[model samples]
Each structure stands twice: as structure tokens, then as C-alpha cells.
Target: MSNGKPVYKLIDGKGRVLIPKELRSAAGMDYGDIVRLGVTNGRVSIRKIDIIEVGDQSPDAVKAYVRAAFKTMPDDTRLSLIAELTELLKQKKEV
Candidate 1:
């Protein structure tokens, strides 16, 4: 395809487009994942709104890591982790 961009796909009767696999992978998207779509100047753009994976240390590394981790985690797991972290923070504050 031109400049490595995926070519067009026919939209279904229900107005859905099948996103290409390579494009999805490049954007870190997978099945069942939600994508954020935006329209600007009559053109649409997409971004992965939920994923903010941490790369090796940058200024906001911890924030990115926690954000990504939270996106895929179940509510129970998130609650447990938050509870643990809260306990640790409370201990630190008390010290």
C-alpha cells in the first residue's frame, strides 16, 4: 500500500470497518479493545485511549506504567493492589 498505510476496506451494512491487522498491531490494539476515534476537518483519527505502557524510564514512567497496568486488570485485582499500596502509603506517612 502507499507509504505502508493500509488500503480501504468495504464497510458492512451496519457501518463497521474492519481494521487491518498490521495497523492494529502498530497501534497496540487487539480484539475486544476499545479505540478512541476523533474527527477533525472532516477526517477521522484514532488513538489507543486506554493504553499508556511504560517504556524505560522517562519523566512520567511510573504514571504510564500504572495506567497501562490498570487498563487490563480486573476490578478485584485492581482493588487488591490499591489496598496494598494504600497500606504502604499510610505506613510511610505514619513513619
Candidate 2:
């Protein structure tokens, strides 16, 4: 899957494209996993979304967890997350 060769896939009539098993395995994707899709400049990207549960945690504990997790995220992902959070905050402010 990492051979630097492109794999072609056909889009079904319903506009669904099936990801091959090898590529999915390489990307750490599996059945039932949540994924984020981004389209830019005629290119489409897919990334698996990681979910974290912080139920009932203290504010400081949650902050600590987020800080640690943020440190390990890729720069692009961190920026995207920040942009999303900013948009949410703006919407909340408007409300």
C-alpha cells in the first residue's frame, strides 16, 4: 500500500467510493470508525477521527488531558481543530 503507486477506484452511482482494504489498513481505518473528509483544490483527504472521553473529570484534569493530547497532534490537525473550536466559540458568542 505504501509503494507510491496510485490505486484507482470507481465511484458508485450513489457517489460512494470504496477504500481498498490495504489502504484502509495503512491508514488505521476500520469498520465503524469515524472519519473526517476534507476537500481542497480538487483533492479529497480522509482522516480517522480519534475520540476521547472526559466524562465527570475535573476542569483542571480535563485541561491537563487536552494539553497532553494537543502536544502530540500533527500541526495541520492542531490548526484545523483550533479553527473548528474558534468557529464554535464565535457561534456561541453570537447566540
For every model shown, the clashing-pair count is: 0, 0
Candidate 1 residues 12-87, lDDT tens each?
A: 9998888788778877887656455679999988777665343546555455556666768999999999999999
Q: Which residue segments of model 2 deviate by more than 4 Å?
A: 52-95
Q: What's the lDDT for residue 30 in model 1? A: 74
> Which portions of model 1 miss their true places by more than 4 Å?
1-6, 51-71, 74-95
Clashing pairs in 2: none
The TM-score of candidate 1 is 0.49
**CA lDDT, every prediction?**
0.73, 0.79
lDDT of 2 by residue, 1-95 (tens): 58979999899999999999999999988765656677999999988765534373767446646765787789999999999999999999999
Q: Report how far off residue 74 is in candidate 1 (Å).
A: 6.0
- CA shift of 38, model 1, Å: 1.3
- Candidate 2, run of 10 with poorest lDDT: 52-61
Best by TM-score: 2
lDDT value for candidate 1? 0.73
